[model samples]
Target: MSDVVKPAVPPPATPARALLPLVLPALVIGLGSSLLLAAVSEAAELFKDVLWETLPDAIGIGRWSVGWIMAVLTATGIAVGLVVWKAPGHAGPDPATTGLVDAPLSPRVVPGLLLATGLALAGGVSLGPENPITAANIALAYWLGRRLVPGSSGQVWAALGAAGTVGALFGTPVAAALILTESLAAAPRPQNPAERTPSLWDQLFAPLVAAGAGGVTSKLLGVPSFGLSLPAFDGPRWPDLLAALLVAPVAAVLGLAAVYAFPYVHRAFRMLPHPVLALTLGGVVLGLLGALGGHLTLFKGLDEIGELAADPKGHSAGALVMMTVVKLAAVLVACGSGFRGGRIFPSVFAGAAFGLAVHALVPAVEPSVAVTCGVLGLLLAVTRQGWLSLFTAAVIAPGIGLLPLLCLALLPAWLLVTGRPQMQLDESGAALR
Candidate 1:
């Protein structure tokens, strides 16, 4: 081979390596999207508060009165039906079934989804619009990215969209990044390993940009995302640790029981001829639960946190126990029967009630502290996110003094729930295919 041969050229960078080139842009886009989502949430909250204020007058009724509430429920059912019919994809399925993943959405469906979510919230369903808002944010980001980056892969755009949505909704860039990675693990994609691994640096930078955007947006829109700042505990005591240990097994049993119960309930409800009929039945169940447990079990429960905080004594310990059971049943029915909403808030409500009941029984641990730990522990079991549970416990508790105790409680709770069966779904809104 006497002829001089030219040196071989290296192969072009892999899609994964090429991720570096896109990172900065993706981060910027994520930040913008986060801010946009924050604005949406803020606006939605304002609209909801205003609606609540005027709703009684509009219906010519008293606030929280039986008639007024029933009117709200019926309107909520109709609105949900319209949204599901008009924008099928926008109506998010049960979060317990969907887990915490972000699903892709078409731009065409965003408006209808948003409208439906807003209407549903205004009508006072025992649901939160955060998931739908998150979906809409992701959809918008995907649409914008595709228009801007014509040759970009759908997977990349979808991931970016999800990242943006998470950053906006969570106010934690790191958390949002993790959520995106976890969510995309199940999505369809190219088989090449080289194309699969996005760089850590890019991942880190993208969420940071999105976080900044979210913070700025929240500030501009006057939305509150109260940081983690609980009161200092005297310290973690043996009693608290022992109590946590005791609670862990109980929580595990309850969680396992819930997973098994949800499917049967859902299957039974699915026998209804229509989604509306299914939801009407759900409304009746919730109404009965509400009537039994009082107004605490009726709504998405975000507003009730303040009341719970202000006067824990106002609620009889027995009522808390009953409310806990009733709310759990209501959430299971709501999700299983195909109502569109998130289970996170309802889970928190149930956990808080459970914790409060536990504290009442023990009388050794501070009720507030017990409530805080229970909230964190139960949510950790349900969501499978330790840090989020930690943060939630710290924030929701009246003081920070219980953080160490809460942390101690979370480990056993996690251990108990780990490896347990999770809710199964074939796809979005389809019967177990």
Candidate 2:
């Protein structure tokens, strides 16, 4: 008989003793990273605003029509291409695929991603800079953790970095925790022991530190925390709750349709001769939508929130419906044609428009409250982030105590939509082909 060898026993963890050593360092690194990210975001936003104010007139001297937009797109494309070519680590993958999870960037690549995203957003691309900001934050955090605590494993640093980054971006520790848990659930596992698993406790610790730092920095910098302080609605009425409940299934179906349609749209666009050609076609489609909606549907929809809120009833119901459809088409085309951006803002726009339409039909409910509930319900249904959806809706129309009604609307929609397969390809972009 052959001799049998016994399996080697692994060393045991030090239980509570080991936790203390990690706690302080993790907080230091997380908080530091969060503060740095806030500074970076403020600077980027200011610069973009300045560019938008000055660049259009300067570029418009020679040509009257489409000159500024064309110039912006070309410049943005070149900047993005350079970043992708030279600093692949900086170019965050499509946010739809990765959701809100953070991944570390090499220090060298952070600048490139930041610049690329800033230019793209400032240039009128239908995208937001948050994804790139989050990417850079995590990367910097990882680099700092590695430098300060040489003994820690790369995986530990990565988890810390992700938690910190999410906290900074969302401005809420609980939301960050939820994002981490969802991301960890979604991440695929490797067959080997060397591969790491992200733990729930690990997700909580760093995000908590980062959120504290972010809140402090946001207050100091005069940046909004994206939190809502809505006015109290007369105690939640059953009729309003029932109406919101009725809307849930509609939103859920729309979200499911979007996910299912995304891949096919993307594949169709990829058949173009080149990325530039694909994007130009996308621009044409967007321009047509803009013609129909009077330029409101063209960009990332950040500035339009105020317009949407202020003039919910000023425009005819037909205009709101037209804007909704055009904006949705523009988003689909933009994402399908290889434009790099996040869908969060666009989803907000779409949801808001949809809510406005719904309000037109049902006259009893307050328009603001109806829009708020609709936006939250649809965003949660599509993105599967109930907390983020709640916060976003509340912030958009603060002073309308609609959270309970919003939650009532959202929870069912989320249940209907969750566990459906995601539409975007994996980070490597392999699955899309």
TM-score of 2: 0.78
Model 2 Cα lDDT, one tens digit per residue, 187-238 = 6776877755445574355456655565455556564344322234575677
lDDT of 2 at 74: 54
Which candidate number maximizes lDDT? Answer: 1
Task: Give candidate 2 regions above 4 Å deviation.
Answer: 1-51, 57-96, 102-108, 184-203, 224-232, 394-401, 427-433
Candidate 1: list runs displaced more than 4 Å.
1-51, 58-60, 88-97, 177-199, 226-232, 397-404, 428-433
Question: Alpha carbon lDDT of residue 326, candidate 1?
Answer: 79
- Model 1 agreement with the true structure over 18-126: per-residue lDDT tens digits: 5566667666766666665555555656776665567667767776677656656666666666566656564655444555446567777777766665665555556
- Which 10 residues in a row give candidate 2 its minimum summed lDDT? 223-232
